[model samples]
Target chain A: MVAGRAGGEVMVRSPGRFTEISQDECLELMATTTVGWLAFVDAEGQQLLPVNFVLHGQDVYFRTMSGSAISSLADGHDDVAFAVDHHDDIYQKGWDVMARGTTARVDDPDLVAQVAAGARPRPWAPGERDVLIVLRPSVISGRRVRRQ
Target chain B: MVAGRAGGEVMVRSPGRFTEISQDECLELMATTTVGWLAFVDAEGQQLLPVNFVLHGQDVYFRTMSGSAISSLADGHDDVAFAVDHHDDIYQKGWDVMARGTTARVDDPDLVAQVAAGARPRPWAPGERDVLIVLRPSVISGRRVRRQ
Candidate 1:
């Protein structure tokens, strides 16, 4: 029983469907996901990295490579936490979203040309990413597991 | 231009390939990855969730559902952080791993029957997962981004 990816009919988690999403469906699923995970704390402590973001309305941008490790958090502790998710594991369904707040370093220049005229994460790694990192979220949460 | 996954024919970022992966190849790639992301600190500061783990030897197991939110961290503060990653966004290449100590609750039923005899995260979400979160790391790190 499969067939799902925005068209419907994929089952396996049909009990109590675990819903709890809103905040404009968690910023419209973090503006159409593009890889996420940026939970910081350096010097070898708590960490989770893997970024490639863009959501620029309520803030949540990304771009790194100043020696990556989240660009050394531009100098650490700017309160973090940013997560985006997706899971289908053969139809168990999925959706998860998280965003806490604080993390700046866009170094103004007309907001980096309005976030490079938006499109997507667009940094397939090469170098000179121009370190962007921006979070701004105060709080936004989500959850979902379905099967009607 | 591509073709990787341990066969060796992928190139893109050739400047010293950013290597630094050991600890037995980061526990053999976290024992064959099965979904990861768990970095904590609540009271609304930092958080990242997305579990489904299993890699017993050096510890790291997961299963939650007893009020969700990672079983409310089995009653808070046990020092967390866990991550597993991958990226090949058209051969930009990637690899990341992290784990930094503390987090327990395996309830000693012979260590949950020796972690239910290994292999796989096996929890597609439903309910009554009986909470079991163990991350005994003491700082394990990794990095990779090939083409050297």
Candidate 2:
């Protein structure tokens, strides 16, 4: 029984007869995804907000400004929340993964270029082309809800 | 020009007109919708995951367990991420919200009962009924990423 974090308990029993997934399975799930959301606290103390994101490998990435949520992180405050999930109303089944970690504005020119080079500018919003931020996971976990 | 997190000297300008949304506007956006994603970091320090979520008023609400992503937050961790966004896939216009805050499990009988009363447990892979988690955003902000 894994000790839970906040208000409840988490029970991850061994999947005996069930199809249990390996780390490879987890990686496989993240590969095809393109977008995600970042949870950041605003400078003023209100829950910052979730923003559309671009998924790249195990790294969650995005571009934003200093006046908003992205800025709060870049200003040297790295406490942040990042999440990714998929739910199909038609299929009625889905999976969710959440990450808590310190986010930093990538400064290394090589790393910045590498991430920026491969990234497809998120077509939805503006300012996606300028600054970039990455959330490195300190603790990552997931839950799958399925109905038979 | 707002400084980039990467120090790229990004302008951090709005997409103009419709792209600017305040924190209150974001709450309205969340209310207009039912499903969003919650992200948290687990024990493994991986970019954990995303789960489809339901926003309950000011706080973001979802059900989770010990081994799941929400479980980490329920464990009483301060770092948590919850987000909600919607976009037209073809039209490429919409808003995205990112929230970062500390997490706590709901023990409030009233809140728990309210969540149980209103939350219809849709199994993503089963086993959500046993756990309850809610994210109270400390900093809530969002962007309307509509093209001008």
Candidate 3:
């Protein structure tokens, strides 16, 4: 199997001569997913929180208060990563897709409204926030685990 | 926020402080808990499978097949990452714990006997395996989401 560059601690897996996912699989998984974690920097310089994100077509979107994480992303501060995975219960197999890209706040009132109209956000949470953020993935990668 | 270089992005966070958990809290969450994902680098690369993990004091243990993912970790391919998160009824509030480290196969017969004598490696699936793998986390990080 191909291995990515091995750093001091974290090993970033690079593309190699493996059976990487096809376009169909990516589209299927991406379409099936609705919620994922939005990784961004928060105040106090700590990895703030993993906010809930929903996928629409080729892009990722989420709603947040005028929170610090949103400000950091809007200021062209890249460091955005979002992940969504689905696993089979009986077979114990599934795939996870992670996207690395820059995130932006959608100022176009129409686009933001479209997202807000579709998303339940957190069904259990009260109230809805008006602002929406979009993430444009620069690098797309994923892998699966199955009984072998 | 100081951004750290990793993967395809940078993460800025407080070079934050980690708190020592109460023993009771640890047992309630770690020991009594049964569902969590177990990650390891297989011959095919990084693999994460959900399983029931039990805590023996500070050390967490789980059982798996004598082959596949377990064997990959034993071969010393890559460090492992195991994680579990639970949301409260409201879905807005929850806690997630991430542990990063390696797995060591139990060898000493007595130690094996001791663990087998009392501990039960509750597999999510109904089956058994001779190769019982114990997960020892080098660092455990967790967070509690509060309603603000």
* Real contacts recovered, all predictions: 0.21, 0.24, 0.01
Estimate, for each residue in B1-148, the C-alpha lDDT of model 1 and write its tens digit: 1211222111112132467899889989878767778988776557788777888888887767577667767664567988887765566677878887888666665566566556343555455465666788888888776433
Q: Candidate 3: deviation at residue A50, Å? A: 5.9
Candidate 3 residue pairs in clash (backbone atoms < 3 Å): A4-A14, A45-B13, A45-B14, A46-B13, A46-B14, A47-B13
Candidate 2 CAPRI category:
acceptable
**Cα misplacement distance, residue B10 of candidate 1 (Å):** 26
Mark the regions of model 2 whose C-alpha exceeds 4 Å error after superposition.
Answer: A1-31, A40-43, A46-48, A52-57, A75-79, A138-144, B1-82, B97-118, B121-125, B128-144
Ranking by lDDT: 1, 2, 3
Worst 10 residues of 1 chain B by lDDT: B3-12
i-RMSD values for every candidate model: 17.4, 8.0, 15.1
Best by TM-score: 2
Best by lDDT: 1
Per-candidate clashes, comma-separated = 0, 53, 6
List residue ranges in candidate 3 displaced over 4 A: A1-51, A55-117, A122-148, B1-27, B118-121
| Tens-digit per-residue lDDT, A9-118, candidate 1 | 11112132568898888899888766778887776656777776778888887767677678777554577889887775566678888887778676665665566567
